[model samples]
Target: MKKHNFYAGPSILSEYTIKNTADAVLNFAGTGLSLLEVSHRGKEFVAVNDEARALVKELLDVPETHEVIFLGGGASLQFYMIPFNLMKKKASYLDTGTWASNAIKEAKFVGEVDVVASSADKNYTYIPKNYTIAPDSEYFHITTNNTIYGTELHKIPEVNIPLVADMSSDIFSFPVDFSKYNAVYAGAQKNLAPAGVTIIIVRKDALGHVDRPLPTMLDYRTHIKKDSMFNTPPVLPIFSALQTLKWYKEQGGIKVLQKKNQEKAAVLYDEIDRNKLFRGTVAVEDRSLMNVCFVMNDEYKELEDKFADFAKAAGMIGIKGHRSVGGFRASLYNAMPIESVKALVQTMQEFEKKH
Candidate 1:
């Protein structure tokens, strides 16, 4: 039986991408050597990197002013790199969750970090609203989706300041106005591909504005000049990411994916609301389409373990919630089959009947 995988990052990928990746692992595109062993600087890998960047621009409708780069060290490196490169003056951040908080910490190390708004008081159950953006601030940073707390900003805020986004969980899951933001970055593991590549799309005008000295690798201009070949890139992951983008394009691109994502979230959220024993964690208006978080009634705490066991026995995996939230979370990314969700809802119904 095919297992229903609901883990958030390094999560499920399309079957076509998986099959192509598997075949390439042994012999890539009729080349004699396995993709895993190919040189990063070779023409084969160069084509892969170039196509991956191009596909991203084409799919997102990124403007001519933007440049896309696939770099190493996940999104964690970007937390520091963004500040180091952009924080010449005061910067503003919206503290939405753990990841956003970490980004604020790194920004403080570089320069003045102003937290314009935060949802920490309510344990990040909703997005904070009605905040002022400083005219003098270098940039305003926001995490588009909160993975741990299961909240998302469906609409990107409009501001005169340069907008920077950490779109790690929801990139390509829906349509985005690429022109509104000065820079956007996402770690590929969640919705794009497996871990190893961090996709950064920055407006060409955003570079060379800061005066701080940067290490060659940390400099955006350095990578831009080299066409993201500043150093040997992650070859296999980039190749796989290209395959995933191709699969996404074949599946009718982001608009179709957005409809599918909304339908998936609606089905799961409807089940959560209809079930008497369960309650959703995030506010209804702010709940995430990617991660659905919920829990049984406090009186039903004794049955938590049994419910989890039952889910596992029925082939549901990674439904366990984060330790901080302590209930259950089902990550419904683009590649997660609708049948898996149907099976999970059926399991929930059966469990409710037993109790």
Candidate 2:
């Protein structure tokens, strides 16, 4: 049976991205050499790097004030790098979930991290509101989407301090006001490409203000100056990202994808709300469009494992929730076709009938 992919990271990829990347892997750019063997310094790979950066800028409408760079480390590295490069006196953070908590942890090692607001009191089920940003804060950090908890910050927080966001799970899912942020970083695994590369779009003038010395590799300036060639980047994932970006543009950019993603989320969420067997995990207002998380209702909780097996048997893969939070999570990334979402809903419905 054909499978519907719902895996979170290293998840679904467009057929266009997959097919083009496969061809390139075998014979890249008609150069008679596989992309795997191509040298980063060579013109062929250099062009790939250049085009990938350009497409990101174009699709995101990234201002000329910012420079986009593809680097090797995941967003996990960026948790430290953000403070290493930006923190002067202290930083402010809004802790919503696991990733945000991790970011706060890393920033503390760099300097003081004032957690202005947090929803950890409620187990991170809702976004904290009406929080104050410290005026002395060097920058404010937030994770736009909580993949594990399935809560998304739909509105960009308005703050005077420079704003930095880790958009690892939800980047490029919709149009963004790029000028609002000093920096936006994400691991490629969720919405862009694979797991090896991380993309950083940093405002050009936001660097060199920090008093502490930054390691050469850790500094954003180092990568910006070298055009992300400070060291050999994650070549394969970068190439795959270029292919995905090309496909994105062909689909009329992120605005179009946002509508499609919304529709997909609505379809599944509606089922979760209407069906008697399951209930959504987070506050309805804060539910994630990219990761739809739900669990069996209290009375039907015993059937959770049976429904999971039923869904899997019906060709729905990766619907299992994260270990920390038990239940089901269907990740509807930019590349996921709506049909797969419907298939998941149907599987849920079929299982509900049996119970």
Candidate 3:
């Protein structure tokens, strides 16, 4: 049976990206040397690196003021790196979910953190609004999408200070105003590439102002100076990212994909709302397009596992929600076919009938 992938991430990738990367593993660019064995600085991989960076700039429409870099650590590293280079005396953050809370913890080590707004009061099922950021704060940080709670800050707040965001699970899934942010970073696993490599886009002027010394490795300038070659980059994921970027552009770019993502989220969410057995966890306005979170209605909560098994038996893979939040999450990333969402909706419908 064909499995419908809803694993969040390291989640589903486009079949094209997967197949191409697999082929490159055997023989990259017809060089007979596997991508795994090639020298990162060699002319072949150099081109790969160059094209990957170029594609990022091109796809994001990143301005000339910003530099895009591929780094080895997942976005977890960026939590500190962001504060390391940007936080001088203080930084502001929005506490929306687990990752955002983690980012807040990391930034506090660097400077004072003002959690301007939070939905943690509600177990993070909603986005906090009408909060104020300190103009005196060094910078403001936000996690654009919360994977755990299934809430999204779909409308980025207008902050006068330098805005930094962790877009780990949602970057490239939609069109964003590149000009508004001083920095944006993401782990490639979700909507970009694979489990390795984190993509960072930093406005050049935002650095060197933090007034403290950053370790050579932790410093953003080091990576920028070396063109992300200050050390061996995650070569496989970078190449695979290039493949995905190429595929994204060929499929009519992010604006096109954003519409599809919205439609896909709508399908599953419609079922969650219409069906008697399940209900969405997040506020309807704040529901995540990438991670649609829901659960069995309170009256039918005991059947959650049975529904999970039923869906799994019907070829749904990885629909389980995060352990902390007991429910279900269907991740609708760029590569997920609408058919998979339809199947999930159908499975939910069938389960409702069975119960």
lDDT of each: 0.90, 0.92, 0.91
List, in order, the clash count of every candidate structure.
0, 0, 0
User: Which runs of model 3 end up more than 4 angstroms from their true locations?
Assistant: none
- Compared with the true structure, what per-residue lDDT tens digits does model 1 show for residues 63-83? 899999999999989999888
Clashes (candidate 3): 0
lDDT of 3 by residue, 1-355 (tens): 9989999899999999999999999999999999999999999999989999999998888999999999988999999999898877999999998999999999888999999998888899999889988768877899999998899988988888878999998999777787888899999999978898999999999889987878899999999999889999999999999999999999999899999999999888888889999999988999999999898888998998899899999999998999878889999999999999999999999998888
Ranking by lDDT: 2, 3, 1
In order of appearance, the predictions have TM-scores of: 0.98, 0.99, 0.98
Clash pairs detected, candidate 2: none
